[model samples]
Target: MKKNLVRIALGLALVLLTLGHSIRLYQHPLLSHLDAITYDARLRLTQPGGQDSRVVVVDIDEKSLAEVGRWPWSRDKVSRLVRQLTDHYGVQLVGFDVVFAEPDESSGLRVLERMGATSLKGDAAFLASLASLRGSLDYDGQFAATLKGRPVVLGFYMSNGIPQGALPPAVLPAGTFKGRNILFTSWRGYGGNLPAFQAAAPAGGHFNPLVDFDGISRRVPMLVEHGGQYYESLSLAMVRLLLGNVPVRPGYAEGGSGSGYAGLEWLDLPTPRGALRIPVDENVATLVPYRGGQGSFVYLSAADVLQGRVAPASLQGKVVLVGTTAPGLMDLRATPVGEAYPGVEIHANLIAGMLDGSLKHKPPYALGFDVVQVLLVGLLLSLLLPSLSPSRATLLTGAVLAGVVGLNLALWQSGLALPVAGVLLLILALYAMNMSWGYFVESHSKRQLTQLFGQYVPPELVDEMARDPERYSMEGRNAELTVLFSDIRGFTSISEGLDPKDLAHLINEYLGAMTTVIRHHRGTLDKYIGDAIMAFWGAPVADPDHARHALLAALEMQVELRRLDAPFAARGWPALQIGIGINTGLMTVGDMGSPLRQAYTVMGDAVNLGSRLEGLTKQYGVGIIVGEATRAAVRDGVFRELDRVRVKGKDEPVAIYEPLGLAGSVPQAVLDELKLWQQALRCYRAQEWDQAELQLMNLVRLNGDCRLYQLYGERVAHLRQQAPGDGWDGVTTFETK
Candidate 1:
């Protein structure tokens, strides 16, 4: 039993380990891409807006870059472009998707240094003019004052591992801050921040868009951590600035309402927009829904802004995003909607999503859904496979998979992020377990049963049985078999002084001897009711000689008990006395009870009579008692007359007998005693008590150890003193229960 437990534990452990590994494989990046595809398809089906004016991209093409010179055109040119859009075109909010960190090198600062301090007023004035021109090098002082307080947005970045450089002087307050509120998300590599541009812009946000491994931009970070402080993103900063606010004033905040996304309170901003409502995951990954390709929305070249090629009305009342979209500039990214996507377009989509209140959300119940799915799928497979045929089961499995996919799609369309890979993997595991169990565990169990029980049972019966089965379920129609009940006499007093462990050991040894005799005669061990054994001969499998088998088993058990007593004597334990009754009749025998649980048993009147007979054995002072039917069924003449006593709980008179020995094995002395007892029983039945007493006295003299002779001696003595009644049936009535 312990070995079986160890094997089961090892199997379960291996199964769990394999399941964990399979889940990890399913969560790999390739599967994530499949999940993304599924998400997109569902969104297309559900979201109200089509991939059109809802989202747009601006491109800084090769033509614009070629026409203007390599990247970073003069600040004067940038200033001119800003003027054309705001002054002439009237763009509502112009946000810069670019950064300028260093002072423009070609602004004449070197020339000013070359001029001596002793120079005349004209020379000094000339130096001042050059300095002014140099100040305009970043075109900062020029555009800075022009764009200041105007709805202009500037971009910044956050870093963790290493700073991309420092924040523009206009934003950083100096030193660092810590804890959850201090934000500047980590980043690596080197870059510069445009100090003047940051100073001029009314609001600025970080343009550090996070991309998942699948190259899809799905989420936006609201804040980032840098050094020991937190900083807002370009998109977020720009939105706050447009609202006439700065970094949010931190306080004790909570996540969003009920949806599992947390909430943050900013003293300046009114509330979180839909896009900002969701918190970034540990890796800063967010979901991005791409509208289409490069020219999907609107693209205005920098040169067009400067050359006045774009209509003033076009920028009027519009949110203008100033960023590079030039493919050669490497600002293009890969997204769901396009192979080559502008990085700046990701932010544009986020801003649009927030304004429209259409951002997707991962519902709070997603994790619950995963857990339930795993359990349900596992249990279903566990039960279903055991009862289904292979072909139909395969179809059922396919249907289940399709159903799971459909459900995942539905959840995604509802703007809930459901984990597809994990669920699919669990289902797959269930399928594998279902398939493997039949071929491996169940098959092996059957083989082991055949190997173990085949030699003991008939070949035909063996063929009909289940392998390693817990119960017998045979095709033979259910029928009641005679039940024989037996127990040791005076067991309570014998065990009173023994220690519990010793008592248990002694009882087991005594019961083991009797039980083996029953099994050897093809009896089904019904149950051990206390020290008594309730056994039946015909059950589960049929026995034609059921009554004969019971009688023979009872006789053999008495003989085995004598032999078993030897070891008990050595241990100072008392010898065991057993009473066995045998009878036969019709009764139902099969797996009877609930479908989930059942037991093989026999129940009927004949069975009850057999138990009553066993109880009567002590009253008659005999080791074995058999009902009239049992005596008639057995062809052997081993049974000798015992009594015609009415067993308790029964009104019917049963002729009980004690089996002495086989006719061939009967000794002359035993035969003489049996004859004498037979004569005494006849005398008692005839009411000839004086003659019965003479016969009992002679039998006791032959075998003083014989319990039956002593019992008859007492009966004759009692009957001799009683008056003869006309209605006397000569049946011995047991006065003790």
Candidate 2:
């Protein structure tokens, strides 16, 4: 009960911790980012693998660098590439995954004008020549003129530090929203194109992806805030530009009544094709629905278009993104499917998804859904597990885990992004708690059991007692019990030829096997003396049918010895044979010994008689011998009455019996021999020596190898020569132990 209480306390603590963390009452780093890793795996598993033909990439790859000089190839060269896309290739629109912040001065127009003013001021022709090439020398002007009326949008970045370059006007300018307050991810700085290029295009947008805590890009925010105004992302801005420069608006969800706070749900872009809805989370972020890895979009080299070597069919009416694929340019990103992904392709995926509406949805209330999910699982497992067995608890926990994953997967398949790692971690934690409560918390009693019975018995016996230790003890007590004694035959001779290690191993293995048989019948071990073993039942934990259990255990031991014959022979060792003796009577059993050491053992005449019977087994040429008391106690057993013998330390002769098998399971032929043997004993006691001798002869003829029959036959012959008195009873006497 104390263990269970501790488990309940731990469970409650875990639930409270999770609750507090989910509700933001407390913060912990250990439990954070687990959801991000699990979500990465889910995204990888469910990635819709195929090429998205809507957006194509014009990569400034190595081929382009080799063909068209190095990076920052003069603006006039870029001008030709743009001209071919618009005039020759018939492309729909283009976007730059770059920021042209610095002016291109590769034309040397400033140098020429400076030389004319300093050295050729008197030469009007030289000054006039430099003035005549003013329009041609201005490369920035050349590139800006090419982008004036084309369907093009330039890209920029926003940072939290400070404004780096000029930022374009917001899609929904400041003071455009009313009534409820809304918040957006705010940025303080940006890297924008030159003023001339910005003025030429209709608009520009930020392309800042919200990298997760682990530095992997999963969600790209649809809107960012600057000076209390909201601006659209590059993907959103690109779609708006593609739809003939439609108007973009902020969408708000109805918040709780009178809270004066609203949830920004989506960015609505009005277009002639149709009105497009871009869903956003509370942070205004959307999970990136990656179609595949890097090759999902078509990649064309910029040099191919400038050199006029590409077909127009590939570029006609295709949305093109101009970005560099060179590693040195540092436009690479880490994604679920790849370690080095191009940043431009990320925008392409997002824009393509916005066009086709394959983007996944993760709303703000999904956090509440995760909290409730964890709590419900915790409650159900805590209530259901304490009443179940260990195996049943394990089975139930596995089913719950499977169900959690299955339900989450089904939701993911339908494009709903929910938290999975938290629920899974909760189930695993609760299961571990439940299992550990039983194992570790209850281990004190198990330690006690092992200390009391480790050497005397097998591990299985201690394990059985560990199930309920209160019922068993080492304290001495008197009880009606059955004691067993067993020893190997000719062990001294067997050990003389073997090494000490081999001999010890052989003995330990034999003893171990016999002990297992004894414990299997619920018997408690007393002690071992050299090659002998002593065990008893109905003591430590009592059994009413101790005699039957002892008898069965003895029979099982003999059968086990037989089964070891081939294995022992294969080891080049001699075959082993053993004798067992069992007796049932009142005896003192418990932890009894000298001051130096005490052991859990059995004592009294019954135990001594059990030992004496084991010694007599060899004399009678049998595997086992049981006292008449034990035979009577186990009434369901079939036995052959050997003789009424007076052993050492006993005045009255006790009847000894050999157990054949369970009742009705013994062979009829053995029963016939037993009947004839009984008749022989009766006639010998009646002093009818001739008739006794005749019965013994018939018994020996039926089973010649039986030593009991031969001994009786010889006794009848001796009694015939010297006739005994009528008072003489048929009994055997032994003077040795």
Per lDDT, the best of the predicted structures is 2
Q: For candidate 2, give the lDDT of residue 198.
A: 81
Each prediction's TM-score versus the true structure = 0.49, 0.59
For model 1, the stretches where C-alpha displacement exceeds 4 angstroms are: 1-58, 107-109, 112-138, 160-192, 214-216, 244-285, 363-365, 428-737
> Cα deviation of 425 in candidate 1 (Å)?
3.6
lDDT of 1 by residue, 299-359 (tens): 7777777787877555666677777777677777766666677778777776665555455
Count of steric clashes across candidates, in order: 37, 2
Query: With candidate 2 superimposed using the best TM-score fit, by how many Å does residue 19's alpha carbon deviate from the native?
Result: 1.9
- Residue pairs in collision within model 2: 162-189, 163-189
Query: Which lDDT tens digits does candidate 2 get at residues 120-177?
Result: 8789898898889988989999999999998888889888775665666778777666
TM-score of 2: 0.59
